[model samples]
Target: MSLSRTLTRRQTLLAGLASGVMLARPRIASAAPTEFVMGVNGGAAYRNLYNNVLRHFEARHNAKVVPVFGSGSELLNRVLAERSRPTMDCFVTFQGAWLVGKAEGVLEKVDYNKIPHIDDVHDFLKDPDGYAPFVNFGAWGIVYNKDTVRTPPRSFKALWDRAYDRKVMLGGVYHWQIHLAAFAYAWTGDQKNIDVAFDKVKELAPRLAGLYGLSSDTQSKFQQGIADIAPWYSYTAQRVRQLGVPVAFQMPEEGGFLYPSAYHAVKGTQKVELVEKLIGTFYDPELQPGLAREDGFIPSNKKTVLPAAVAAELPTMEEVQRCHHWDWALINRDEGAWLNRWNAEVRRLVRG
Candidate 1:
């Protein structure tokens, strides 16, 4: 890792932190309800967390827990569209998306009093004003076929290196690459770094074997020997390797960003306390090990121990902290325009 590069990114994050953007919470929370609904994104990690840990919470509290699964973007939009008459009490979201929703005033503030586990949560999970809180922390890494990636790309830049020509795959129509471009630019002090990153993407695009919108698609491609590498969350990378595909995951010396999926209480719901309990239960220390082991996300609660498996799958916390933090405020302010630019300029260049 380049110390100079790492320092530059930290400086940018510090500048954003100094801006004092007030912590924004969801717009409303309903009164306590007997039965509550939760929005979830599918697959094993989500299923284990919801079906196993969450079911335990329900049994203990003697309340009903309904799980509504969908794509991350779809579920978040559902919450926003139903803001006036919230159909779901709480929705799970990736930190990046959750931060965007919080800025848009779609999430409700959590009541810590009803849920004491707030105290166990790390400082990063708790907004200064106590609005959004993390349920789990996730990281992004590369997955490579052992036979194909004899010397896997060590950094994001490797994806663009001509050496891996026609052997690499990148996620498209998603925020992973977008955030990565932003991080790369922020680290290099390149105001136009996002575009630069996109240029790199275009350079490597022609050599790309495939583009995946789903984790399963990426995994299948690797298994079938169609493509050797894919950008994915650490959990997915871990699971893929376990399938005996001779896969290895990397956090890259450039460092990957930290993202946490959090519980957002929808405002104007009749399940405020129930929602709080649901959020709080995720922070329980006893539950963290199980979550980290089965789900592959770091429990947001500081008291939660990071299982060896989960820790092995992701970069060290210090390494994660080293990566450029995506200033959500800035991203929120410009993501639409940036995304539009990406679609028109970046994607067009790739297609050509």
Candidate 2:
């Protein structure tokens, strides 16, 4: 099945499950409640964390959460389509998509008064204008099998080495922009110019074992020893390691990419109070560490203390300082033109 069809099927299945839960509950005397539909990433790791939060919110507020899962872009499209009569009460997406939602005026400005927990979040993680506030973040860096690569790679340049030919796996086209930005900075000391990055990627194409569109594909490659190294978010790397895959994560010496997962209230949502409660629950210091532990995310709640092991696995403050934060607004604006250039120039040059 096509990816879209597969995602639609998954969403249907999950929605059915949510419906079942609602039906199973016995009706009791209480005020009429609202059903808050949240759009979130359709990945197992993300669902695990969100589900936990959902359970707690449901119990406390007596409201049902109907989760709609899809890719960030896909969810954004849904929000736009439903702008006349929005269905999604809130959206959980990455920084780039959040910017797009803000630019499109599909997101509601967050009101801090409703979510007192907002004060506990580190200032860096808070959206200055409060359109989308980051709940958790993870660093993007290199993942490698320790058994295969005795010498750990400390830089993005390692992916270009001829010695690892046909042993490297890269993220698919959609994710290449981040890699391109990293390469642009590493090669030309300019993150905005992609010319250098494109040339470098074309050079490394012959060495690539494969390009993965999903986390499962990347994990399978590592499991089968078909790939020795790849680029991925720290949460994924941590999950793979937990599965005893002989994998290790390294923040490249040049630095890494900081990818923040944020939440936005849909512009026309009627459950503003409920949405605030959900967002508050997501960033609650009591729940933040557990959510972070589920996926190795760095909690944006400054007061949430992580376990020693979880803390060790995350990017240190110094490492975070070295990481690159893209001009997402600019990238989102030019994404189409960039994708066109990539397909016509870089992708066509790939070997096999």
Candidate 3:
């Protein structure tokens, strides 16, 4: 992961393909278009992404993409369940789920050479073990109702204050780990301390509104006034604002946390070429900028630049570097024990 080495290699590989896309070998016009399946979370934002950014990739590859949309865990289970003969060719998900997939034998150790984007991506975003390369990420932090809370919150400690009683909400399952990691780091100076998180969730339970199961649930609660403040990613915050709720997001005192998404070929699938093509589409300098403009995501491709106005609204590269790093592999290993403890102590106590 040396910067000097990456730069030297990038210069050599990018020299020959400077003018055009480094694409998969061209598909024959007479052959039936290959149908490639991609797993994604189903929702309006994802649907918009498919229509705007992904469709072009499909066209260029002469492939018909069939997206199988579900939550991160659901998609992981689907691939694991279908491991013998994978109906899905590519698996796309967040870090936590990817960790599980890697441990459970559902994912392959990706060939970095096959994924041309690996060189263009920020060094931190590429998996050193080569499971997958992160395509994009959004910083997760405090999202609060502007009307109720006149001032912006500065720390994770703010969520536990009696000031927001019966008003706090946090995102989907994987988000539970993000929330846990933040408080764990704040209290113990260790993000891997799930024990601290378990204690904090219980301590915050009297005030806890809900542990949301989906982004839609958070949007609905924010719209209906059931949640006054919570932890959410930039995109989910935007959706809450679209619901006509006056919500604002901030990088908290503890700093924003990183939750990234990546796509890799399923272990037993025969669509490696198409999967590599999809990853190349993510790294394409010309096309990668659209994801930032359309979805507020921070692209992994270093060459992808955001418009001045759009860049102003999103977290800067400096802020992205300072965001808290997640120990997803540890979380995935302890998830079973943590969930059991959470249900025993924290779940039944949540009011919403």
- The 10 consecutive residues of candidate 2 with the worst lDDT sum are 25-34
Please report, in order, the local distance difference test score of every candidate based on alpha carbons: 0.69, 0.79, 0.77
What's the TM for model 1? 0.81
Better of 1 and 3 by lDDT: 3
The residue pairs that clash in candidate 2, if any, are none
RMSD of each: 18.3, 12.0, 12.4
Per-residue lDDT of candidate 1, residues 1-352 (tens digit): 8777767777978867655443332222322435878887767656677654787788777777778988667888998888778899888787567776776787888777778678777777766666656777767756688787888888766777778777776766765444445445634754346666656565666778766667777778888887887666766666555566677767766766566677778777777777788877777888877766655665666666675756675556676666555566656666677777666665554431
Which candidate gets the maximum lDDT versus the true structure? 2
Compute each candidate's TM-score over C-alphas: 0.81, 0.86, 0.85
The list of candidate 1 runs beyond 4 A from truth reads: 1-33, 176-183, 186-192, 241-246, 306-310, 348-352
As a whole number from 0 to 100, the lDDT of residue 83 in candidate 1 is: 77
**How well does model 2 score by local distance difference test?**
0.79
- Candidate 1 all-Cα RMSD: 18.3
| Candidate with maximal TM-score | 2
lDDT of 3: 0.77
Is 2 or 3 the stronger prediction by lDDT?
2
